[model samples]
Target: MRPAYKQILEAVVVTAELTGSELSAHAQEVMVDDLMAYPLDAVLQALTRCRKELKGRLTLAAILDRLDDGRPGADEAWGVVARALGDESETVVWTEEMAAAAAPARELMMLGDKVGARMAFRDAYERIVSDARSERRSVTWRVSPGSDAERRVAAIVRAVELGRLPAAQAQLLLPTQAVAERHLLLTGSVMTEQERRAGREHVKKLLGMLRGGKVQVARTAG
Candidate 1:
């Protein structure tokens, strides 16, 4: 880890202690390594949000989980994290050289081309997901928010939310979005098969509600 990251981790550990929480030395190192993947400010913001929102004892894993929750700059800083896509049998891992290919999307976003960025990301992401699915593997990791499929959904969600894309697209993306959100929540945690099935069923309900229409919007009182 970089000296600066170690310094930040130390500061966070001290702050956690002041807040009546304890951060283990090993945990602190792990958090710093994971966080160093993003811009410094984005990592700090995630940590700050965790400190403000979590009650009771603060753990390093909890803070890292908060970062994965699509908090502000976290998603933007997510970039192309699809390091490797593992097969269903777990026998092989397919990796994509994404950073260079995905640079256009990042540039477009930086240039205020929200639509172009979203489109670019979606195109690259969908292509990746298609390959992964064909190999009978879930998108292992590609960025924050979850798998490549989930990231694709998130890209559409961002565009729609920004009014850069039509809400009609929401129906198409919401199902995968639900799956992605659940998959993300389940990461680094243990759960039963029943619970997993229940999660999928819950996400499926969204399909019926979204069918044949753009997402519904509530009107405010005039």
Candidate 2:
């Protein structure tokens, strides 16, 4: 991929890290639309009807875009994300021989202690978890409206501090499926016949939903 595209992907992933869960089903759809650059009405409608900031949806979109980079319509999807995000369009500018050795021309700003950052993340996660609990919805480490993002970020920092996760996940965090795939491939364990068939069927059904217009659009496709 081009450097510009890679930058956009990186930005989306970072943005998702900033946003947490709390997004509705429709909001999640719009968020995906924004990150992948598909249609924008989905996101616009979601933003207009929703009372809150919809940060969760926005973040989720970025996460999915980064995690499922191999999905069909990757570039086209980023286009949509640009329109919905307005000025944030810069975040998704499509590129790929990117930032080489560059000079540190700007002033190096200092940051607070790690304790402060951790505390902030912890608080945010707690709030999201409390909200999810109140809604009576199950929160998973992957898609829950909680501090999963923060935790993942913390994990990366910890890994860097300890020199670990980079070799495995690279700069981007892996989704549940990605982690599983890597594990299976590394272990040299073949998927069982039933498992392989089931996986194929699941993919087929998902594609069918997207193409056949079975997608649960909370609003018009526009």
All candidates' lDDT scores?
0.50, 0.36
Model 2 weakest 10-residue run by lDDT: 97-106
Can you write out model 1's per-residue Cα lDDT over 137-168, one digit (the tens) per residue?
42222222234554456554554544444455
* C-alpha TM-scores of all predictions: 0.31, 0.20
Tens digit per residue, CA lDDT, model 2, 1-222? 655444444444444444543445465445444434522343333333332444445543233222322221323423322232233212121112000100111111114233443344334433443343334343221111123444444434343334333334433443333332433434546677687667667767777877667445644564
Q: Taking the candidates one at a time, how many backbone clashes does each contain? A: 1, 19
Which model scores highest in TM-score?
A: 1
